[model samples]
Target: MEYFIQQLINGLTLGGIYALIALGYTMVYGIIQLINFAHGEFFAAGGYMGVILLSFLSANGYLATYPWLCLSGAIILSMAYCSLLATGVEKIAYKPLRKSSRLSVLLSALGMSIFIQNGLMLTQGVYDKAYPTIFSQGGFDFGNIKVSYMQIVMLLITILLLILLNLLVFKTRIGKAMRATAQDKTMSSLVGIKSDRIISLTFIIGASLAAAAGIMVGMYYGSVGYTMGFVPGIKAFAAAVLGGIGNITGAMIGGFLIGMIEIFGAGYISSEYKDVFAFIILIGVLYFMPTGIMGENIDDTRV
Candidate 1:
């Protein structure tokens, strides 16, 4: 039971990160029906940005005196940076192909992914940059279970972000506009909603979430790499699909499920087969529920 609890906590932590990343996938697909293969690059960019900003703080002696403040500033700045980056990617790569075939848009997204990945490698180098040790060292003990401060922090941020997102989607006027635009772009435009703006906003929001996930992952793992986003990105995409691709709630649930499966599979079976275990579960679930665990009655257009 102690071992099970340990793995469960680990799973939730990993799941939260994946949920953050997966939300990006679901939101974008909900709005535009695009898979957005380049979305992962935003995560990578956020990790790099977080490391860069935090390192600057450390160098300037700011982090030592005000660790939490510095960390918060880094996260906000990274999210903003990624939001701007997503906007640029949307305007440059996706906007022009809005009326084009799905294949063209998909190819463009793939090209953008390659382009961004290579750009990161060129600019940040292929080496893994170590995150400054701050919260990485501390943890709390509950009986035989051990939990890190990083895990607590990560979970709080994840839950907070998720709540804020739910409120944004279900409560705000902008969110209403987004939902309307998703449901019927032409009709929404005719009804005075700007579909283009909503689409851009969707991209911005998704990128911001991915950015947060990137920072959390870096803090948890103690390092960041230029190539770090690819696998997690793919897994998050699987989570999105598993949860019903375009459904927000589904994405979150799918992410947690995938994370739990990976952790348990690693704990009981072998670490070497962790990734395979995640995919296998995804396949099994899809085989039984083609529309995903939460895909039922979810309009693809509603966020």
Candidate 2:
């Protein structure tokens, strides 16, 4: 039982991170029907930005004196940086190709992904950067189960961000516009909503969330690497598809399910085949539920 509980906690932590990244995927797809392959680079950028900010604080003697404050500041700054970066990418690479063929936009996204990854390599190098040790240590124990402070922190932040996102999408006027735009971009524009602006906002929100996940993952794992985003990005994209690509709630559920499956599969079976298990489960679920666990049939009128 204790072993099960331990694995469950680990699953939740991993799932939350995936959920964060998946939200970016689903939101972008919901708005534009295009997968921003460069999305993962935003995550990588955030991790790098966080490490840079945290290290700067430590050098200035601020991180040791006010650890939490420094961390919070780093997260905020990294999120903002990613948001701006996303906005630029959307405007430069995506917006122009919006009216063009889906294949063109997809190719552009792929190009952007390679460009950003190479940019990161050029700037930050291929070496892995280590995170500060201040927040990664210590944890509460329950019998034979152990949970780290970083895990708890990651979970809390993930939950809080998810709640805020739900409220933003469901309760706010902007969310209403977003929904309207998603349902029919032309109609929404005719009704006075700026589809372009809404699409850009969607990218901004998605990138910011990915940035937050990147920072948390870096802190939890004690290091950030330029290549860190690719595999997680692919997994998060799978999670979005599992949950229903355009559905926010579905993405969250899918992310958790994927995370749990990976953790349990690794725990009980061969660790080397954990990823294989995740894909097998995803395939099985999709085979039965073609629209995904929560996905609706996407028609031409949509997005």
Error of 1 at 150 (Å): 0.5
Candidate 2 achieves a global lDDT of 0.93
Tens digits of per-residue lDDT for model 1, 214-301: 9989989999998888999999999999998888999999999889999999999999999899999888888998878888654545
* Per-residue lDDT over 161-204 for candidate 2, one digit per residue giving the tens place of the 0 to 100 score: 99999999999999999999999899899999999999999999
All candidates' lDDT scores?
A: 0.92, 0.93
User: After best superposition, candidate 2 residue 79: deviation in angstroms?
Assistant: 0.6
Report how far residue 133 has shifted in candidate 1, in Å: 0.3
lDDT of 2 at 276: 97
